[model samples]
Target: MKNIFKFWKKYSFVLLIAFITLSLFDLRFALAAVICMAAPVFSAVFKGRFWCGNLCPRGNFYDNVVAKFSRKKKVPEFLKSYLFRVLVLVLMMTVFILGIKQNWGDLYGIGLVFYRMIVITTIIGIVMSFVYNHRTWCHFCPMGTISSLVSKSRKNKHVLNVSADCVSCKICERQCSLGIIPYEYKGELLNHADCIQCGKCAVVCPKNAIGYKST
Candidate 1:
């Protein structure tokens, strides 16, 4: 299981690129992007962002970018890491409410608003990933924000800390592109709204103290 997970994590970026290319060539293939939209739904039922951790192309790109740069910035610990979650909720509520009221059936809907929103949000997500921490966009990402919320509600949800095996080496925290303090989280496992489950923490962990499991 571990080997399979590692292999998927290593190659996820390549696969995501292929999916994007196929989506461009074939409209039907656009469903590939839905994987990002749908992955959290699956995680909600299963209790982990399995796709985000091991399959998301965007996640892979952001992780690499943050890992390459941003090592100098220090993240202050805070209890309300859900700031990202709040932004996502506001955006979604605005879009869905406004979109429904405006009624996309109007000719102006797709061109003026829908397409513009999509383009602007996409740019924001990509640019933020490069400029800020990895998966930083996930905090405000409508898709991820929704997923994180749903994934935490499952009856079987569990956070596997295994921190006893951890050595207080800040590697996991430092390498975490999402800015989560792996050592500071005292839960049995991480169920936070900000966790994109990119698995970089686990990868960087020297003692392999952090990992996830569903109850």
Candidate 2:
């Protein structure tokens, strides 16, 4: 996991490129969404937020744009939860009820609109990060929200630090990009919904504590 950027791990980058390329065609974009929906299923089945933690450009964007700056002043947890959920609901309603069609004329038009949407989302998320945490956009991320719900419903359990070897260094907690406080969890399952399963915590654990499997 430490060599996360090695060969096969680069599939995340490929997925991002595929998403962008598919945005040129509405059918393809829809297909991409369907494929993305499968990400958490795979994560739950295998072990990780394989898409978001590793492949998601949006996640990386937040890490670079927000987390890099605000190490000391973490965003208040409640604001990221309730307030952000409200904003996401509003935005979702706007998009769903209004059906803002940005596709103008040709394939280029479609791609342009999709590109603009991505940029706007990135911009808003980055701005929100100044006031919130790295997951400011995650509050509104449709894909992530969907993934979280699905993974939960599926009961795809992951094996966290469930052994006696755990030294309680809290490295897992600190390395967790999902903002999970690992020491608090007592069950074999890592119940934190925000957990993306990027495997960073597992990789960084000095005691080799964390592991995952499908239930």
lDDT of 1 by residue, 95-165 (tens): 75586478556544423443344445655656554555445555566666666667666533544453567
Q: Candidate 2 clashing pairs?
A: 49-196
Query: Candidate 2 regions off by >4 Å?
Result: 1-48, 64-67, 70-72, 86-90, 100-113, 158-161, 213-215
Best by TM-score: 1
Q: Residue 121 in candidate 2 has what lDDT?
A: 67
**Any idea what lDDT model 2 has?**
0.58
Q: For candidate 1, give the lDDT.
A: 0.59
Model 2 Cα lDDT, one tens digit per residue, 12-33: 4454456666765553363344
Candidate 2 displacement at residue 143 in angstroms: 1.8
